[model samples]
Target chain A: MNNVYLRNSVRFILLILLQVLVLDNINFRGYLNPYIYIMFILLLPFETPDWFILVSSFLVGFGVDLFSNTMGMHTAASVFIGFCRPGVLRFISSTRDYEQGMTPSIRDLGISWFLKYSIIIVLLHHIVFFYLEVFSFHEFFYTFWRVIISTIFTVIFIVIGQYLFYKKK
Target chain B: MRQLFRFLFKYYFFFLFVLLEVFAFIMIANNNYYQGGRMLNTANQLTGSIYQSYNNIFDYFNLKETNRQLAAENALLHAQNENSYVKITNKLFKVQDTTYKQQYQYVDAKVISSSTGKRNNYLMLNKGFEQGVRNDMAVVSPIGIVGIVNGVSNNFCSVMSLLHSEMKITAKIKKNNYLGTVVWEGGSYKTGTLLDIPSHVVISKGDTVITSGHSLDFPEGIPIGTVSYFKINQGDNTYKINITFFTDYKKLDYVYIVRNLFKEEQLKMKGVQHE
Candidate 1:
C-alpha cells in the first residue's frame, strides 16, 4: 500500500511539473495547446472508486488552474471528464467487466482499446474545457475550432506518452 | 425516508460530481464579474505560499534582465540628486510637529503570481493586511500604475491588474493636463482606452498620460502611458482615445502598495452635509 501511495505521488508531481513548466508555456498559435496532464485521470486503476476518481481529477485540475490563473475552467472540465470516464471505460472495454486492479494503459489494455479510451476521454475534456473558457455561445465556430484542434493534439500526446513510458508490472 | 436514503446512497457519486461542478461554475461566474468580491483568490495562504516558492525558484532565470533594469534606474536616480544646494539658513526655523504633513506611504512588495492572458486578470503580491496592505490601496509597478488592491489576507494580497476590463484608472494628459478615465477592453494587453476627455482638448497622438490622483489611492502625476490614437465619439462629445500602457504586465514582478495616510481624514468629510 505504501509503495502504491509513493508511486501515485510521483506520478502526480511529475505530471503537474511538466504541465505547468512546459505545456502551459506552449501557446501553439493559441489553438493547439495540448492538455497531456489529463492522462493522470486516464491511467488511474480500474478498480478505483468513482468518488475518489472525481475528487482526484478536480484537485489535479485545480492545480493547473492555479498556475494558469483562469479559475474554475479547468476544474469544471476535469470533473465532467471524470464523471464520464467509467461509462467510456465500459463502452470501449473488450470484456463486459473490467478486471479488478487493472490499470488503463497501452501495455495493459492493448493498442486499440487504449487509443479509443484516450481519445474519448481527451475529446470530452477538451470540448468541455474550450467551451467553458468562452462561457457563451457568442463565438461558436471559433470556440469549436479550438475544441477540435486541442482535443486532437491532446489525444496524440497522451498516446505518445503511453508508448514512451508505460511498463508491465 | 428509508427509500429516499437508499436512492441517494446508490447514486452518491453522481451527486458529489454535480455538487463539485456546480461549485466550480459558481466560482467561474463570480470571477467573470457576474458578482464581485474575492472568490478563492491567490491571496489565500495556501495558494500564496505555493506561488511564492515557485517564483523564488524561477526568479534566478531572470536575474540578468533584472540586474540591467536596476542599473539603469540607479543611474537615473543618481542624476536627479541635488548635492550642491546651500540650505544652512533654514535649519533654525524648520519646526517639528507642524500643521499637516506628507499623507502617503508606499509599502514595497513582490508579485509572486501574475497573468495577463485572461479577460479579467489579477496579480498576487507578497504583502498582506499583516504588512499594512488593505483593500482599495493602489498598487503600481516601477514602470506605471498597475491597479487597485482587491483583497488582503494574512500574509498575501491580490491586486486587480490593469488588464482587467473592469479596471478604471483615472488619468490625465500631461501635455495639457486634461483628465480622462483609463479603461481596458481586454483583447490586447498592450493598449487601453482613455474616455471622457472632451473633444475640444486638441490632444496630440504622442501626449503622455499620467495618473489624475483624484482617487486618494495614488499621488498625482504617476506615468500611465502615451496616447496612441483618438477620435470623437459620434454619440457623445468625448474623445475615444487609445493609449499604449507603459507597464508590461506579463513581466511584472515587483510592485508598490500606496497607502493613503490621510484616508481617515478624507473619509470624514463624507459624513457632513454639503450646502
Candidate 2:
C-alpha cells in the first residue's frame, strides 16, 4: 500500500517533467497543444484520502504552472477537475457496485464508461484552462473554437497515453 | 455532538474540495501580480536548448528558401541605396551628412520554438541574457515586427508574439500619419485590428501602417501591416480597421532583437518629469 503511494509520486514527478520539458514545446499547427499531465489526477488509486487527492492535484497543477509560466490557469483547471472527480466516478460507477480498493480503469469501468468519463473531465479541464487563459468573453465565439479544438487534441493524447502505459495486462 | 462529528467526518472530502478550489481561484485571480514568468525562464532555457538541437536538424530543409529570401532582400536594399545616392548627388555636389540616423543595433537570433495559432502565442529565441537579450526588447523579422521579449534566461528568451491577444503595438498610417493601437483579435495569425482611429482620419484599403515610435521599444517607420478593411462603428466615431500583417508569423525563423541604447536614460527622464 505504501509502495503504491511511492509509485504514484514517482509517476507524478516524471509526468510533470515530461510535460514541461518536452510536450509543452510540441505545438502541432499551434492549435493542438496536448496536455497529458492531467493523467496523474485521472489515475489516482480508489479509496485514497480525499485530502491527499485535493492537495496532490493542486500541487501537480501548481508545479506545471510554475514551469509553464501560466501562473494559475493549470492550477485552477486541475483543481476544478479534482473537485468533480468523485461525483463523476460515482455517477458512472455506483458506489454499491464499485469493488473495494479497485482503482478506476477501462477494464473496471468498461470502455464506454471510461470514454465518457475521460471526455467529460478533459472537456471541463480544457474549457476552464483556455477560458482562464484569455480571461474574457469579449471574443466568446473565438474562445469557443479554441476550446473545441484543444479539447479534441487533449483527448486524443490522453487516450493514446492511457493505452500505451496504463492498460491492464 | 458525537452524531454531528460523525456526519462531518463522513463528508470531510467535500470540505477539502471546496477549500482547495477556493485557493485555486485566488491564485488565478492574482496570477498577474506574481512574477511567475521569471521562474519559468529556467525551464525556457532548458527547452530552448533542446529546440535548438531539433531546429538544426530541420533547418537544412528550408535552407534554399531562406537563402532566396535573403538574396532578394539584399537586392532591394542595394537598389534603394543606389536610388538615394543618385538623388543626393543630383541635388548637391558635396552633401553634408547632418541628419542624425537612428542609432539602432540588432542581434540576430534563431527562433527555437514558436506558436502562431493560439490565443496567447509566444516565441522562444535562441539568444538570451548572455547575448544581451532582455525583457521588453522588440523582436522583428526581415519583414516586420514580431513581438517583445517577455522573459529571459541565460541562453534563451521568450517573446509575447504579435499574434497574442495581449499584444498591443503603436502604429500609424504611412500616408496620413494617423496613429492608432494595433492588436490581435484572437483568431488569425495573419491579421490584426487597429483601434481608436477617429472617423475623420481618411483610411483606405492597402494603406500601409508603420510603427508610430510613441514607445521606446520599436523605432519609427518599422512596417507593421496594411489596412485590409475599415468601417465606422454604428454609434461610435472610431473606425475599426482590419490589417493584414506583412510578416507570415507562422513561418518565422531568424529574427532581429532591437536593443535601445538610450532606453534607461529616456525612461529615467520620463519618470522624473512625471514625478
Candidate 3:
C-alpha cells in the first residue's frame, strides 16, 4: 500500500510539472489547449472513497490554477468531474460486475465502457471550465465554438495519456 | 438512530456528489479572492521561462533583421548627437547653459514572450520589479509606443499589449493636434483604430499620431502611428480613423521602459490640491 501511494504521488508531481511547464504553453491556434492533467483524477483506484477523490481533485486543480493564475476554473471543473465520476461509472457498468477494489481500466471495464466513461466526465469538465472562463453568453456562439474545439483536443489528449501511462501494469 | 444511519448510508453516494458539487461551486465563485492568483502567476512564470528558452532558439533565424534595425537606430542616434553638439557650441558662444534635468528616462529590456493574435494580447518582459519596473510604466520600442506594464514579478513583468481590447492610449494628430483614443479592433496586427476624433478635423491619410502626454505615464511627443484611412461614421458626427502602427509589434524583440521620475511627486501634489 505504501508503495502504491509513493508511485501515485510521484506520478502526480510529474503530471503537474508536465502540464504547466510544457502543455499549458502549447496554444494551437489560441483555442485548442488540451489539459491532460485531469487524467490523474480519472485514473484513481475505484475503491478510493468519495471524500478523498473530491479533495484530491480540488487540490490537483488548485495546483494547476495557482500556476496558471486562473482563480478557480480548473478546481471547479475537476471537483465537478470527481463528483460525477461514480454516477458515470454506474451508468456505464453494472454494480455487481464491478469488483470492489479493482480500479477502472480498459481491461476491467472494456474499451467501449471506458471511452463512454471518459467522454462524459471530460465533456462536463470542459463545458464548466470554458463557460466559466468566458463568464458571459454575450459571445455565446463564439464561446460555444471554443468549448467544442477545446473539448475535442482535451479529450484526445486525455485518452492518449491514459493509454500511454496507464497501460496494463 | 440506527434507522437514520441506514437511510444516510443508502443515500451516501448522492449526498457525497451533492456535497462535492457544492464545494466546487463555492470555489469557482470565490476564485478571485483566493490564493489562486499567486499560483497562476507562478505557473505563468514557469511556463513563460520555458517558452523564452524556446523563443531564444528560434530568434537566431532573425539575426539579419535585428542587425539591420540596430544599425538604423545607431545611425539615428549619431545624427541626434551631432545636432546636440552643434547646439552646445552655439550655447557656449552665447554664454548659456541648456543642460537641464530630464523628466523621463528609458531602460532597455527584451521581450521574452509576446502574443499579438489574441483578443487580449499581452507581452512579457525580461525585466520586472527587481529592475525597478512597476505597474503602469509605459513600454515603447524605438519605432513607437507598445503598451503599459500591468503586473510585475521579481524578475519579470507583463504588459497589456496595444493589441488588447481593453487597451486605450491617448493619441493625437501631430499636424492639427486633434486628440482621440487609440484602440485595437480585436485582431489584425497591421491596423488599429482611433475613436472620438471630430469630423471637422482635417485628418488626411499618412498624418502622424503621437502620444498626448496628458497622462503621467507617457511623456509628451512619443510616436504612436500614422493615419492610414478615415471615414465619417454613418450616424455619428465623429470620424473613424484607421492607423498603421509604426512599430512592427510581431517582430518586437527589444523595448525600452520609460519611467517618469516626477510622476509620483506630481500625483501627490495633485492629490493634495483635490483634497
Candidate 4:
C-alpha cells in the first residue's frame, strides 16, 4: 500500500510538470497539443477508493489548469472520466478479473486491452474538453477536427510513455 | 431517517462527482464571462514563480534571436536620433523639453509564457501591478501591437493576445484615412480581418493598416499589419479585408505595456460630452 502511494504521488507530480512545462509549450502548427497527464488517472490501482479517484482527478486536472490558464475545462473533463472509470473497467473486464495490485497499464494488461481502455477514456476527455474550450457549436466541424486529432496524438504519447517508463518494472 | 442515511452513505461518490462538476462548470462560466478571474490565472503567485523559473532555464536559447531584434530596433532609433541629423537651418532653434507633455509611458516586460493556438489566447508577462502594469493597457512589440493586459497580480500579469477571438482594434488605412475594426476570426495567428471599411474605398493589395487614436488603450498610428486580401461584402456595403500582422506572436519575447497618462482626463471629457 505504501509503495502504491509513493509511486502515484511521484507519477502525479512528474506528469503534471511534464505536461505544463513541455507538451503544452510545443505549438505544433497551432493545434496538436497532446495531454498525457490523463495516463496518471488511468494507471491508478483498480481498487483505489472511489472518492479518492474523484478528488485526485480533480487535483491533477486543476494542477494543469492553474499552469495553462484553462481554468475549468480540464477539471470538468477529468472528473467526468473519474466518474466513468469504474464502469469502463467493469465493461472491459467481463471475462477476466483484475488480480490484486493490477493497474490499467500496458504492463498489467496487454497492449490491446490497454489501448481499448485508453482510447475510450481519452476520447471522452477530449470531447468534453475541446467543446468546452470552443464553447460554441457554430464551428462544429472545426472543433470536432481538433478533438479527433488531439485525441489521436494524446493516445499515441500515452502509449509511448507507458512502454518507456514501465520497461524495468 | 435511518433509510435516508443509508441511501446517502451508499451513494456519496455520485454526489461528490455532481458537486465537483457543478463547481467546475461555475469556474468555466465565470472565466468565460468575467475575463478576470484573478485567483485561477497563471499570473498568480505559485504558477507565476514556476513559469519564471522555467523561463530562467530556457531563456538562454532565445538570446541570439532576441539580440538580433534589439540590434535592428537600435539601428532604427539611431537613424532617428537628433544628433544623427545636421542642423540644416541653424537659426537659434532652441529645443525645449517642456514644449511637449508626455501622453504615454511604456514599461518594458519579458513574455514568460504565451500561447497562440487556443481560441482565446493569452500571454503572461513577468511584470505586474508592483511594476505599474494595469489591466487594459496595450502591449506592443517593436514590430507591432501584441495584446492587451487582462489580469494583473503582484509580480505578473496575463495579456489577452491580439489573436484572441474577443480582441478588437480600431484600425485605419494609412493612405486614404479609412477607419475599420481589426479582429481575429479563429484562423491563422498571422492574419486578422479588417471590418467597417466601405466597399468603394479603392483599397488595393499592400495597403498599410494602422491603429486609430480612438481607444485610450493604444496611441494612434501604431503599425498593425498590411492588407493581404480584400473583397467587397455584397450583403453589407463593407469591405472584407484580410491583413497579415507584423508582429509574429509565436516568436514574441519582449513587449512594451503602454500606460495612457491622459486616461483620466479622456474619461472626464467623455463624461462631460455625455451630459
Candidate 5:
C-alpha cells in the first residue's frame, strides 16, 4: 500500500512537470498539442475509490490549468473522464474481468486493451477541452479537426510513455 | 430518514461529479472576460516564480538569438538618436520640444512563458504592477505589435497575444491611410486578417499595414504587417485582406510594454462626450 502511494505521488508531480515544462511548449504546427498527463488518471489502481479518482482528476486538471492558464477547461474535461472511467473499464472488461491490484497500464493489460481504453477517454477529454477552449460553434469543423489531431497525438505519446516507463515483467 | 440516508450513500459519487462539473463551468464562464479571477493564472505569485525559475534555467540557451535582436534594435535606435543628425534646423528645435510632450513611455520586460498553439494565446512577462505595467497597455516587439496586458500581479503580468482569436488591432494602409481592423482567424501565428477596408481602395500585395492610433493602446505609425493576399467574396464591399504579421511570436523573448501617458485623460474626455 505504501509503495503504491509513493509511486503514484511521484508520477503525479513528474507528469505535471513533463506536461507544463516540455509538452505544452511543443508547437507542432499549432494543432497537435498532445496531452499525456491524462495517463496519470488512466494508470491508477483498479480498487482506488471512485470519489478519490474524481478528486485526484480535479487536482491534476487544476494543476495543468494553472500552468497553462486554461482556467477550468481541463478541470471539466478531467472530471468528465474521471466520471466515465469506471463505465469505460466495465464496458471493456465484459470479455474478462480485472483481477485484484491490477492497473490500466499496457504492462498490466495487453497493449490492445490499453489502447482502446485510452483512446475512448482521451477522445472524450479532448472533445470537452478543445470545445470549451474555443467556446463557439462558429468554427465547429475547425475545432473538431483540432480535437481529432490532438487526440491522435496524445494517444501516441501515452503509448510511448507506457512502453518507456512501465516495462513488462 | 433511514431511506434518505441510504439514497444519499448510494448516489454520492454522482452528486460529487455534478458538483465538480458545475464548479468548473462557473470558472470557465468567469474566465471568458478580459479580467477574470486573478488567483488561478500564471500572473499569480507561485506560478509566476516557478515560470521565472524555469525561464532562468532555459534562458541561457537563447542568448545568441536574443543578442542579435537586441543589437539590431540598438542600431535602429542609434540611427534615430539626436546625435545621428546634424543641426539641420536650429530654428525649429525649441518648437519641436514644446509641441511633443512625451505621450508614450515604454518599459522593457522579458517573456517568461507564452503559448501560441492555443486558440486564445497569452504571454507572461517578468515585469508586473511593480514595474508600472497595467491592464490595457500595449505590448510590442522589436519587429511589430505583440499584444496588450490584461492581468497583472505584483511581479508578473500576462499579455493577450496578437494570435488570440478575440484580439482586434486597429490598422491602416500606410500608402493611402485607409483604416481597418486586424484579427487572427485561429490557424497560423504568422498571419492575420484585415477587415473593414473597401474593395475599391486599390490594395497591392505588399502594402504596409500600420497602427492608426485610433485607440489609446498603441501609438500611430507602428508597423503591423504587410499585405500577403486579398479577395472579395462576390457580393461584399470589403476586401478580405490577409497580411503576414511582422512579429514572429514564437521567437519573442523581449518586449516593450507601451503605456499611453494620456490614456486616463482621453478616457475622461470620451466619458464627458457621452453626456
Candidate 6:
C-alpha cells in the first residue's frame, strides 16, 4: 500500500527473475560464481522489522533453491545472515544512528561503514552457503577458497548494485 | 506459562530464525539422500516453463553450433542407414535379416537449464512425460553420455549429471576391461574420479573409459572419458583414477534421452524372481 512496500515488492520479483534467469547462467570456471540475489536481502531498510527480515530471507532462499536445485542451502545461509544482521548493524553504527526509511547504502552510511557492513554479512553468508553445500569439512581448503572467492564476487555485485539502484539521502 | 510466554515474546525473531534454519536443515538432510525434493525442484511445470521461455531467447545465440552438431550427426546417421546397406554374397542365401534388434530408442530434448558449479550438478530438460521421458532415463549428448533422469514433470525433467557428488556411474577401462565407479568431488566440473578398479590391472594414460551397461540408465560402451592420471592407494588394493569426461557440461545444449522399450518387462521379471 505504501511506497517502500511497493518498491520492496517490485525488487523481490526483479531480483528473483534476474537471479534464476540471468545470473544463474554465469558459469565462472565452474566455480566462484557470484550470487547477486542476496543483495535483495542486503538492501532492505535499516529499520525493517527483524521478523520480516528473517522470514523474507527464508522465503527468498527457498525461491532460489527452487531454480538452482540447492535444496535449502540458500535459505539456511540467508536466514543465518538475517540473524546476524542486527548485531552487525549495531556493531557498525555504534556511533551514528540510522534514520528511519533509510537503506544501508554507501550514500546513507558512508563508504567505510557500508564496506564493513557488506563484507561481514557477505562473508558470513558465503561461509554458511559453501559449508552447507558440501556438508563436510573434509575438503576444507576447497570449500574455503570457494567461500572467499564467491564472497568477494558477491560483495562486488552487491556494492555495484546498491550504487546503481539506490541513491544518496 | 507466563514466564515462558514472556521469553518467547522477547526473542520471537531469534526463535523464528531457528525454526526456519531447522526447516532448511531438514530439507538439506532429505536432499542428502536425494539430490532434490519432488515438491521443490525446478523440474516442475511452472519453473520449467520459466526456464524454457528464457532458453527460447538464449538458444538463438548458440543456433549455429547446434545446427553444425546436428548436421554432423545427421551425416553420421545417413552413412549408417539401412538404405546404405550393401547386398553381399554369402555362402548361404541370407545375411540381411535381424542383424541388430533395436535395443534403445532416443527422444530428443533441449537443456533448458544446467549448472556446473555445485557439489551436485543438475540439468533441466525441456522434454518430460509428454515426450516419454520417464525417471532413470539415460540422457546423452552427441559427444557422450550426460546424466540420468532423476525427476520428471509434465513438460520437463531433472537430470543428475555425472558431475554430481551423489552420482556413481559404472564405467570400465576399454583396454584393460577393469570396471570402476565414477564419483565427482566438489569444485571442478572438468574432471571426476573413477573408483574400485583393482591395482593389479595394468592401465595407461589416455585409456578410454565407457559405460559398463550394469545399470538400465545407459547402454554398454558409451564414452565416459579417458584416464587422466591414477595412483594406487598404499593401504588398499584399488586404484583411484581421474577421468576427463567427454561431454563439456558448460556448452551442453541438445541431448537425447534413451528410452528402453524392454525395461519394464525386465524389471517385472526380476521382481518376480526375487519374489
TM-score of every candidate relative to the true structure: 0.77, 0.79, 0.71, 0.93, 0.95, 0.90
Listed per candidate, the RMSD to the true structure in angstroms reads 5.3, 4.4, 5.6, 2.5, 2.1, 2.8
Task: Report lDDT (CA) for all predictions.
Answer: 0.80, 0.80, 0.76, 0.89, 0.90, 0.84
CAPRI quality of model 1: acceptable
Q: List residue ranges in candidate 6 displaced over 4 A.
A: A167-169, B29-32, B35-40, B82-100, B200-202, B235-237, B268-275
Residue-wise C-alpha lDDT for candidate 3, range A39-146, written one tens digit per residue: 788778888888788888888887776555455778888988988887888777744486665666665666677677777888888888877765666667766776
Ordered by lDDT, highest first, the candidates read 5, 4, 6, 1, 2, 3
Q: What is the alpha-carbon lDDT for the whole of candidate 5?
A: 0.90
The chain A TM-scores for the candidates, taken one by one, are 0.93, 0.91, 0.90, 0.96, 0.97, 0.93
Residue B94 lDDT, candidate 5, scale 0-100:
58
Pairs of residues at least 3 apart in sequence or in different chains that clash in candidate 3 = A66-B39, A66-B40, A67-B39, A67-B40, A67-B43, A68-B40, A69-B40
Task: Please provide, for model 1 over B11-128, each residue's C-alpha lDDT reduced to its tens digit, 9 standing for 90 to 100.
Answer: 9989999998998898676654422445336467876887788889989988887777668767777777776445679558765666767888989899887756444677889998
- Candidates 1 onward: DockQ, in order: 0.34, 0.37, 0.25, 0.63, 0.74, 0.67
- Better lDDT candidate (1, 3): 1
- 3 or 5, greater by DockQ: 5
Report the C-alpha displacement of residue A136, candidate 3, in angstroms: 3.6
In model 3 chain B, where is the ten-residue run with the lowest total lDDT?
Answer: B34-43
Model 3 chain A is weakest, by summed lDDT over 10 consecutive residues, at A94-103
Clash pairs, model 2 backbone: none
| Model 5: per-residue Cα lDDT at residue B209 | 100
The interface RMSD for candidate 6 is 1.7
For model 5, what is the alpha-carbon lDDT of residue B174? 99
Q: Chain B alone: TM-score in each candidate?
A: 0.84, 0.84, 0.81, 0.92, 0.92, 0.87
- Best candidate, lDDT: 5
Residue B140 in model 2: shift from native, Å? 1.2
Candidate 5: misplaced stretches above 4 Å? A94-97, B36-40, B86-98
- Per-residue lDDT of model 3, residues B108-196, tens digit only: 98887665544455677888777898788899988888998877777787777887656889988998888899998643676899999
Candidate 4 Cα misplacement greater than 4 A, ranges = A94-96, B31-41, B86-98
Better of 2 and 5 by lDDT: 5
Task: Tell me the lDDT of model 2 at B102.
Answer: 55
Residues B179-250, model 5: lDDT tens digits: 999999988788899999998899899999999999888999889999999998578799999999899888
